[model samples]
Target: TVIDGVTNTTTTVTAGTNPNAIAVNPVTNKVYVANLNSNDVTVIDGTTNATTTVTAGTLPYAIAVNPVTNKVYVANFGSNNVTVIDGATNTTTTVAAGTSPVAIAVNPVTNKVYVANQISNNVTVIDGVTNTPTIVTVGTSPYAIAVNPVTNKVYVANQLSYNVTVIDVASNTTTTVTTGKRHNAIAVHPVTNKVYVTNQNSTNVTVIDGVTNTPTIVTTGKSPYAIAVNPVTNKVYVANYFSDNVTTVIDGVTNTTTTVTAGTNPNAIAVNPVTNKVYVANSGSDNVTVISPSIDTALPLTTAVTSSSLVNVAGISNATVSSAPAFTFTATSTYAPTAPAIRTVYYQVDSASGPWIQASGAGPFTATLPAQSKGDHVLYAFAVDGLEGGATAGSSGEGSGNSPMVGSVAAFAFSVIDPLAQIITFGANPGPVNYSPSGTFTVSATGGASGNAVSFTSTTTGVCTISGTTVTMVTAGTCTIAANQAGNTDFTAAAQVTQSITINPILPCTPGNFSATGNAPCTPAPAGSFVPTAGATAAIACAIGSYQPNSGSISCTLASVGFFVPLTASTSQTPCPLGSTTLITGASACLNLPLLNIDNSDPATVYDANTDAVLLTRYLLGYRNADLIANARGTGANLRDAAQIETHLSTYIPTNQALSPFDVDGDGVVLPMTDGLMILRRLLNPNALNVMTAAEQSAITANAKRGSLTDAQVLQRIEALKP
Candidate 1:
C-alpha cells in the first residue's frame, strides 16, 4: 500500500496492529510494514490492499531499503538480528548483529546499509553489493542512522551519549559531536543535503552540515522521537512522542516552528523526497499518519553580498547580497515591481554563493562578469522597480510555474564560449621528374580555391614561373608548382609532373642509283660507241653487218673509224636537233681510205661476231686488219688481255675463226662475212648488236638468195633484236 502524505491517508492497506515502520517501494507502490506485535512483516499490495504476512525476527522496529538491489533490511530489536528480505522473492535471511538494533539507513549512492545498535553503542555497515557486514565504532547507544546523499555520509544519533556520529561512507571513518541529550531519530534534507537529528531528552533538533559535519541545534516542543525532511521546501519535521504532535519548520533559515498533530505515539517517520511528504508510524494508535508541507514559504531576499545571492536593485552595479538579498519578482505576480531599474550581476569563487563583487559593463545593455575561481559559478540578476507605494523586484527571464525567488533575476545566468581553426587537406601528392629533357614544367592549380594562382619553379635553379587559374604547361620536366595566395610568398601547396619526349632521326638515301647525267651511259662504253653499225638505219643491217657493243668489252667507239669517215661540218642536216647527228654519205674518196678498206682487209667475207678485230689485231697481232678486233684495257675494265676475249668469243661462236687461209676468200684476205658465223654469234652475245652464228648466217644467206627475203625471216630477225 502506498502512503499519500498530502491526503493524510494510506492507499490499499487497511487498519493493521502496531505497524512499527512503513516503508514504501516507490517502484511497485507496495507498502512493507514492520509489525512489532506480530513479529512478522506484512506485504500489502498497493493497488489491491491484500495483506500477506511473512514471519520474521521478533519486534522488527526499523527497516531500510536498497532500491538498486531490491532488498530490505529490518532491524529486529528483540531478536538481535536484522531480517534481510529479498524484495523479488519475499524470502528472508537473518543476519547477526549487536544488541538492540534501533534504526537502519541505506546509502543509495553505494547501496550500503548502516544499522545503529542502540544497546551495543556501535554501528554495523552492510555492503549492498557484497552482502557483508562491517562493525564500526560510534557513540553510546547509537539509535538511528540518516545518510546524506551528496556527501555519501551516514549520521548516527547516539541516544545515551547525547551526541551524533558522522560516518564518511567512502572512507568508513567517524566523527562524533555531542548535540544535547538523548539524540534518537535522524533524517536528511534532500534539497539542502543536511542532516536533522532529534534530541529526545533536550526537546531540540540538531542540524548537521552533510558536507562539513558541523551541527546546529534547533529547539523544539517536547521530547522528539521521529524526524523527517520535506525535500521540496527543504524543511525538517520532528515528532514529539510525549506531545502527540510533530513540529514542522526549516532548520537553518527559519526562526519559528509549526506543529503537525498526528496519531498517538508517533515513533517512526519516512519522507518521500520526490513529493515532499512524510509518513509517520503511530504505534499506540495502530495506524500511520501522513503529513505535507502546509506552511512552506519563499525565502526572503538576502542583503549581504554572497556569491550565490542575486542582486535585485536597478542601476546598482557594485552590489552585495545576503540576508536582504535580491528577489526575482514576476511581472504578473503581486510581488512584481511597476518601474524599471538596472540590475547588477556577479559570481563567486568555485561556487554560486560567495562575496559579491562588481563586473565590467560593455556596449549597450551588456554586462560582462569578471573571471573568477576555476570551479563552476552562477550569476543572478534582478531589477528593483518602484510601484505606487514601495519598490519590488522585477522578473527577467525566469522559468514558469516555480516559486518567485532570487532565481527569477534577468541576465543572471550566462556561460562563456570558445573559437578554433580549420585544417586544410590536399588531393594529389608530388614526385619525380615527368619530362624527357628535364626542363622545369609550369603547372596549373585546380580543385582548390578559385582564382588562386600557382607558381612553378625548378627546385634546384630557383627559376620561377607564375601560373594563372588555368595554366598551360610549357617547358616540361620536374618542376615544383606551388599553389599560393597573393602576399603569401611562402607557398603552402605544391605538386610535380613528369613527361617523356620522343623524336625521329633524319633518314638518308636508300644507298642505290641516282645520277646527274642519265645513268653512266647504261654501261661503261667508249664515247659515241654505237650498239650496231653507227650509220645503219635498217634492222637487217644491224642483224648481220657488224659486231658492236652497248655494254661490256665489245662497246665500239666512233673515234676508231676516223680514217673511214672524217669529221665533217660542211652542212647542217636539220634532220634532228642542231647539235645532233643525221645520216650523210661520206665521199667515195674516203671509202677507199685504208681504215675503211674492208675489201683489202682480211677476206671481207668473214667476221668474228664476238671479237673486236681491230682492237685485237692492232694490240695483239700488231695490225689494224678490218677483220681483226681491238684489245684495250678500259680505265674501269675488269679484263686484262685479248686472249680472254678470244676465249670468250670461242664459247659464243662454237668455233674460233682464226686469220687462217681456210677461212679466207680468193682475195687472200678474210673479211668478217656478213652471211657467216658473225650473225649467229651476235644472237648469242647479249652485249653484241651485229655478230651472228653459222646457222644464223646460213638462214639469212638462204633468205637473200631467194631474191625477196621472206617475211618470216624478217620477223625472226626483229624478234631476236628485242631486249
Candidate 2:
C-alpha cells in the first residue's frame, strides 16, 4: 500500500506473501518489498503499480535500495545470506552472510552495502560493484544499520549490548557509544552528521553527535522500534510499536520532541525528504500509516519569508540618505491539521528581550523601521498563527503564541551610518593649457561624510564639461567647474567650491611649416618648404612637382604648367594666354611668338610659308561673289572694281539681301576694294588679315588643311608677317 503525502490518499498493490520490509528507489520511484514467508522480493512500479517478483534467500527480513545504481539489497534471516537484485533486469544474486542478517543499508555515493547480522553481532560490507563481502565485528546482536554516504560512515544498532556502533567506512574501524538498551533501528542526518538510534526497551531515542560521539537521550512513545531522519529539516522520527504512535524530535541547537498517533505496532519508519512526510509500517495493523510533518501542531510549520523586497544590509552602518527603505516581509506558516493561518506578525529591534510590536495586517506585510543611532542593530520578525491561543507577554526573551501552534522567527543585523561631515576642497586645479592636445583637470571633495555623494557642474558648458571629479576641456575658453555635496540629516551640506579651467586653441600649420614628431605644434620651415602633419621642428622644401601658393598650408599643391610659384612665399601669378609659351618656373604669363605667312601643310609640324599659302588658297576658293553683293547691299556700301563687281554678281542674291559675308573688317560693310584688298594682304602677310573675325580665324585654324591647328600655331603664322 502506498499513500500520497499531498492528497492523503492510499493505493494498494498486490505483492508476495508476508512482506516484512519495504524500501523505495526515489530516482525510479520503484518500491521493493521483502516477502519473508515467500522468500522473494516483490518490485512495484510506483507510477504503474505493477508488481514483479524475483527469488531471494530464504525468509528475507529487510530490504534497502541504492537509488544511484537502482540495485536492491534484501537481508535473508532464515538462509543467513543476502539477495542483491538488479532493478533493471529483475535478477538476483545471493551472498553468504554471518548468522541471520536482518537489516540492510546502502551508500549510493560509494556503492557500498552494509548488512547487520543479528545473531552474529557483526556487519557484512559488500562492494556493490564487485559483490565482495568484508565482515566487520560490532556489538552483540546488531539489528539495524544505516550509512551516511557524505561522511562514508556506517552506524549499527546492537540490541543486546545497549549501544550503537559507528564504523568508519574508510578504515573499517568501529567506535561504540552507550545508548538505551534494546536499540532496534538506526538513522543518520547527513547535513548535521548526527546519529539517531531508536531504543525499544527504553522507549526513547539516543542522539549521538558525529563530531563529539556523545549521546543525548530523548524520550519517545512506548517501545519505539524504528527511526528515520530528514536532513533538510533536521527532524528525527521514531516509531513506537507498543504505543502505536511516532515521536518527532526537532534536532535544533537543543533537541525537542513531540508525539503523533500512528497505526498499531509501528515497526519501521521511512521519510520522503521531498514532501517532509514520514511513513510508518505497522505489523499489528497490517497497514502503513502516513504522517505529514506539516500536520504536527506541536511542531508548527516554521514561518519563513518565502520572498522579500528588502535589500539585505551587510554591516550595521547604513549610509542611505532617502527615507529609510521600506521592507516587505512575506512569511509562510507551516502546514498543520487545522490548516493554520498566520494571524499576526511581530517585530522587534535592537534586542529580542522587549515586548514585540505586532504588525497591522497579515503578511507578506510592509513595515518601516525607525531611524537608529549609529551603531549595531538587530531586527527580529516572526509570525503567530490562528491556532495559537493568543500572544502572551513573557519576561524571558521568548514570546508565547496560542496553544497547539508555535511561531517561527528570523533575524537581521545591520547598522546605521553616521551623517557625513561637511568640508569642501579641490584635489586638483587647472594647470597650464596647451593648444593642439586639449588639457584636463580634476576636482574632489576633501572632507565630506564618508560615502557622501558629490556632484560636479560646469559654469561654461560650451567650453568644458565636468563628470564626477574630472573636468575635460571642450573648446578654447575659460570655464568654472564646481563640486557640491548635499549632506544628510546627520551632517551639514558642504559649501560649493569652484575652480576655473581654460582651454587653448589649436595652432594652424604654416605653408613652410612641418611637425617632425607628434604632440608639438608645427613650426616654421625654411622658405618654399611644407609638411603634412603637426609637431614638426623642420620643414621640407616643396618637391620638384609640387608647390605652395598659400602660407600655413599643411601640404603643397602640384604646380600648374602655365603658372608657377618659384620663390619662397610666392603668392599670385597669371596663367599663359593662348598663342604664347611659358617654359620655365615662376613665369607670370606665356611669352608671345612671331607669326609668318607660311603653309601649315603638316599641322603637326611648325607653321611655315607653304602651309600659310595652302590656308589662303582654301579660304579664297571658298569665298563667293554673292557674299560681297549681299554685304554691300545690306550695309549700303560701294563695290569698288570690276573684279569686285564680277565676284558680287557671280551668285544669286536673295531679294531681301539679309545675309552679309563680305564684311571682312567686321565693320558691317562690304567695300570690295577694302575687304578684297585686306584678303590679298592677309595672304601675303597673314598678320594683316583683319578681314577675318577672331571666330573666323579660330575656325580656320581649327579646320586647317594639314589637320586641326592650335591657337598658338595659327598665332605663329599670323605673327610671322607682322612688321
Candidate 3:
C-alpha cells in the first residue's frame, strides 16, 4: 500500500513474494522492493503503475538506490552475493560478496557500494564502474552499514563486538569506534559528520563524532532498531520497536530529544529533507503515519508562567528546584484547533528521550513527577492539542492524533542536596606475605554512603581467599583486597576502594625425605637403610657386598675386599678365622685347608725306615695287632690327624688295627707282599738304585688299583716312607 502525500490517499501497488526492503531513485522516479522469499526485486515506475520483476541473489535482505548513478544494489543474505541492477535497463550483475551479506549502502558521489557480511565479519567494497569487489576486514558480526558520500567514508556496525568500523576510501584503513552492546542499526548525517546507532540490547543510542571517533550514549526507549537522519533540520529519527508506538527525534545540535506519537510497533522510519517531514512505517498496525513538525514543533504559546513554571520540563524557564514541584500549563495554538492548545502535558526526567508521563485534561492542568535523581537534571516536555491531522499517538496516553504539540524547549534544571558524605577507608598496604600463615586486616568506614558495615573481599580469587577481614594466601602472585561499606538513608553509596597484598611462594623439599610435589615436611629413612635422591620414598638395604651402619643416610658403603657382609642391613663385615679364609669380598662362609691323613705308623713330624717302618711291618704280620698303630717308637703312631691335630678329638683319624690305615697304596688288600713290601722297599732304599724287574718295581700287586699306582702316590699316602 502506497500513500499519496499530497492527496492523503492510499493506493495498492503489487510486489513480489515476501517483499521486505524498499529503495527509491528520485532522479528517475523509480521504486525498488527486495523480495526475500521470491529471490527477486519488484521495480515500480513512479510516473505510471507499471511493475517489473528482476531476478536477484537468494534471500535478498536489503536494497539501496544511487539516484545520481542510476543504479540499485541488493544484499542477498542467503547466497553470500550482491545483485546490482541498472536503473535504466533493469539489467542485473551478480557480484560475489562475503559470507552472509546482511546490509548494503552506497555512496552516490563516489559511485562505490559497501556490503556488510555478518558471518565473515568483513565488508565487500564494490566499484560501480566495474562491479569488482574488495574485502575489508571488520569486527565480529557486522550487522548494519552506512556511508558518508561527502567524506568518502563507510561505517559498519558490528553487533557482537559493540563497535563501529570506519573505513577510509583512500587508504582502506579502518578505525574502530566503541558503541553500546548489540547495536543493530546505524545512520550517518553527512552535513554534521555525526553517526547515530541504535543498540537493541542496551535500549540506548550511541552517537559517534566522525571527527574524533568519540561516542556519547543517548538514552532511548526499549529495543530501538531502525534509524534515519534529516541533515537539514539536524534531527535524527529512531524507531523504538518495543517502546509501544513511539519514535524519538534527537536534535543533532543539543543531543536533546522530543517524543511525538507514532504508530504501533513503529519500526521503519524515514525523512524528507526537502519537505522537512518524517514518515514511519508501523509493522503492527500495517499503515504509514506521516508526522509534520510544522516549523520548530507545533508548540502552543503560553500567556504567563503558571504555578510551578512547567514549560521546558527544561520547561521551567531555566529555573532550578530543590524538590519535586507540581506543574500547571495554559497555552494557545496558532492554527485554531478544535480543542484547547494545551490539552495534555507530557514530560520526562533528564532528557526528552522518553518513557514520557502525560497529564491530559482541561485548562490549568496540573501533574507531578515521581522522585528524581540528585544532580543537575533537565525535564523535557511537549503538549498535544486537538487539531486535526497534526501527529499520531504512539501510546493510548498520547491522547488523540489530531494535534501533535510539544512546548518550546525551555531549559529546566534542578538539584537535590545530599545530607551526609559516607566513605570507606582501608589501612596502609601490608607489603608481601608468606604463603604459610594467613594475615588479618582491619577496616573503618562511614556507613551511610558506603552502605552497610565494613566487609572485605579478594579480587584475585585464584591467588587468595578472604573471609571477613582475614586473607588466606592460596599461591604465589599478587592479591588485591576490596573494602566496601553499603550506605544508609542519609547517603546514596560510596565507591569501592582497594589495597594490594603480595603472597610469597613455598619452597621445595630437602634430601632424606619423601615429599611429593615439592611441598614441606620430609620423611626420614629407616634404621640400617639409606636413600640416594631428594624427596625419595624407596629405601635401599645393605647387601652382601655393601653395608650402611647409620639410618637416614644418602648412600651405603661397600664392604672391604677379603671381608663380607652375610646378611641384609648388616652394621659391619666379618673376617675369616685362622685355618680358613676368603680371597673375595662378601663371602658367606670360609673353606677349610685340605687334610693330609697319611702317616699311619707315626704321629711325629719326621719319619724314617729304621724305627717307623719296622713297627708297621711287624704289626701288619699280625703279632699283637693293637701295638701296630700304637707304636711307642713313633710317638704313639698316628695318635692325632692333620685337620685338628692338637685339640679337636672329633676330627682325629683313629688307628685301624684290623688291617692297616694305609695299604701303602689305595688297593683293597693289606698283604706283606703288596702294601707292607712297598713301604719297606721305599724306606730301606731311600735314594739307592733298584735291583728288580719292571714288574717287581710296579706297585707290588696285580690288582689294577695297586699296580697302576706310581711310587710317588704310594709314598705320599704313608707320609713319604724313607730311612
Candidate 4:
C-alpha cells in the first residue's frame, strides 16, 4: 500500500515472500526490501510503484542503503557475507564477512558499512572506498549495528551479553555498556549522538548517551526488536514483534512513549526525517506500515530574515527595520507536502494598496532592495504547490484555476530610519606640563549636539589612560588623547579630535637640616649613607667600626674584626698583616714585638756549680781521700745545686768516716781531695796521673780515652771521677 500523505490515500503493491528488512534511497526515490525466504532483494520504484528483483546471498536478513552513494547492502546470515548492489548499474557484488552476518548499517557521510556477525560475536567494518573488511571484536552474539556519521561511532547490539558495544570508527576500539537483556536491534540519532537499543526479552528500549555511555530504559510493547531514530526530531521508533505494534519514543528533555498499531510481527523499522514519518516492516503480515507524526499547527511555516540588520524580521511576524541597506529571507515548513512546492514573499511600503511586489521566489530566498527612506513598510509570504497551482486565501490569484492548492500568508510590518551624522571637537588642547605624583589630568570635549556622549582613548596606554574626560598619567612619556562620539539614528558618526600631552620627570624628595641631598654626603660614605628617614634633620652616625658606602641608606654595615677603620664614617677598613695583633675593639695599627733565640750548649752557666762545690767542701772537709772519692762518686749527676749535694753527702756518710764521691782515680774507692787535686792536675798538665794505684790508673786511662778531649770533656771526666 502506498500512502499519499497529503490526501491520506493508500495503494497496495505485492512483493516477494518474507521481507524481513527494508531500506530506502531518498535521493533516488527507490526502496530496497530484503526477502528472507526468497533470498533476493526487491527494489521498488517509489514513483511508479514498479518492482525489480536482485539475487543476493543465502538468507538475506538485513538491508541498508547509502543514499549519497546510491548503494544498497544486504546482510546474509546463511552465506556469511554481504551483498552490495550499485543502484545505478543494478549490478551485484559479494563482500566476505564474519560468520552469520545478520544486521547491517551504513554511515552516509563516511560511506562505511558495518555488519554484525551473530555467531562470531563481532562486527565487520567494510571500507566503502576499497570494499575491504576489518573485523572488530565486540560482545557475545552481536545481532544488530548502527552508526552515527557525525560522531563516527558504531553501536552493536549484543544479544547474549545483554549490552551494546560502542566502536570508535577511526581507532576500532570498543566500549561495552550494559543494557536490558537480549538487545536485538540498535539505532543512533546522528545529531544528538544518542543510541537506541531494543531489548527483545526485556520488552524495552534502552537509550544510551554516546558521551557518557549510560543507559536509560524505557518500557515498550512485548518483544521489542527493531529500532530506528529520526536525527532531526530526535524521535526513536521501536518495532515490537509479538505485540504487533510500533512504539514511538520521543527522545527529548522528557522521554515519552506512544504506541501505534502496526502490521503483524513488526521486525524492522526506518525513519524519514524530512517527511517526519516512520516505516516498519512486518514479516507475519507481509506488509510495511507507515506512521506519520502529529502535525504542530502552531508554526506550520516559519519565516526568518537571514541577511543583515537591514530587515530585523523573523518568523513571519512584524519587526523593526534597521538602518542597514539590504537583507535575505528564509522559511521552514512543518507540514510535509506531497508534491513540489514554491514559496513566494510579497512586500509593500506604507500601505496594502496596489499590486504586491514579488520579493522572494523560494524559501530561504534572497532579494536585495534599494535602501528605503525612513518610513513604514509591510511584507507578506506564502507557499504554493507547483502541480496543483492553487493559492491560499489572501494570496495572489486566490480561488483561480491556475493558483496553487494550499498556501499560507504571513504579514510583517516594520519601520526604517535615515543614517545619522555628527561632528566632535575637543574644548582645549592639553600642553606640556610637569609630571604629577598622582598621575592625573582633566580634558573636555566641546563639539557635537547637547547630551552627546564622548569617549576618550589614548595612542600610548603606557604613558596615560583617559577615562571619560580625565587623563591619568602613568609614566614620563608623550601621548595623544582622542575624543569620539558614535552617532544615533538621527545623527551621523562624529570625527575624532586629538590632543597631545607631554609629562616631565618629577624632582627627588628634599632632605632636612644636617642631611645632604646629593648621592654622596661624607667622604667615605659614598652614595648610600645612614639617614633614618626620607627627610631627616641629621644623618645618623655609623657605629665605632661600621660604615655605609651609598647615600640614602637606612642602616650601616658592621666592620669586619680582622680589618680596622680609624676614621669615622669610613666606607672601608685596612687589614692587619700576618705577624701582627690588634685590639678587638678598634685599632689603628698592629704592634710588632722583639723575639730571642737560645743556645743549648752551655749547661754549667744554667746550673749552680759554685753552690754545689761549697756544699761538697763542707760535707768532705776532713774526710780521707778514699771516703771523699766514695762520696763524690755517690753524688753523680744529681749534684745540680749546693743544698742538694750537701743533703746527699751528709745523709749517706758512714760511721767509720766514709764519704761518697771521693774517688780520686775512678777505681771504685773513696778519695776526696786526692781525686779532686788529681783531676785538676790532669786538666792543667797533659801527662800527670801517678797518684793512684796501677789498676786505678789503667781504669782512669780507659774511661778518659776519647779522640777529641777538650777542657769541657776534661771537666765531665773529673766530675765522673768525683761521683
lDDT of 2 by residue, 566-628 (tens): 444443445555444343444434445322212212233233333333332333345434442
Off by over 4 Å in 2: 286-288, 294-723
> Order of all candidates by lDDT, from best down to worst?
3, 2, 4, 1
TM-score of each: 0.41, 0.42, 0.42, 0.42
**Worst 10-residue lDDT window, candidate 3:** 309-318
Off by over 4 Å in 4: 243-245, 259-265, 279-290, 297-301, 304-723
Report the C-alpha lDDT of model 1 over 1-723, residue by residue, as the tens digit.
Answer: 454445655555653468777676543335688988889888876656778877779888988766545688899999888898888789988888788988898775577888889898888888776768889889988877888765778888887878888887778678987687887677776446677888888888888777677778787868888777655345677888888877876543563687788888887676664445677778789787777565436323222222323322222222332322232222212344532232333323222233545333421122334443211123443322222232235635353333323323222321121111112232344323232232332343332232344333333222223334222233433334444333211122323332222111222212121123322213222222332322222111111112333322223322221112232211111122111221122221121112111112243222322333333233233333232334322222243244544543333223233322112122222234422322333334444324555455455444223223443443233232221
List runs of model 1 lying over 4 Å from the truth. 1-17, 260-723
Rank candidates by TM-score, best first. 4, 2, 3, 1
**Model 4 poorest 10 in a row by lDDT:** 592-601
Steric clash count of candidate 2: 31
Whole-model lDDT per candidate: 0.51, 0.65, 0.68, 0.65
**TM-score: which is higher, 1 or 3?**
3
Flag regions of model 3 displaced more than 4 Å. Answer: 296-723
Tell me the alpha-carbon RMSD of every candidate: 27.6, 19.8, 25.3, 27.6
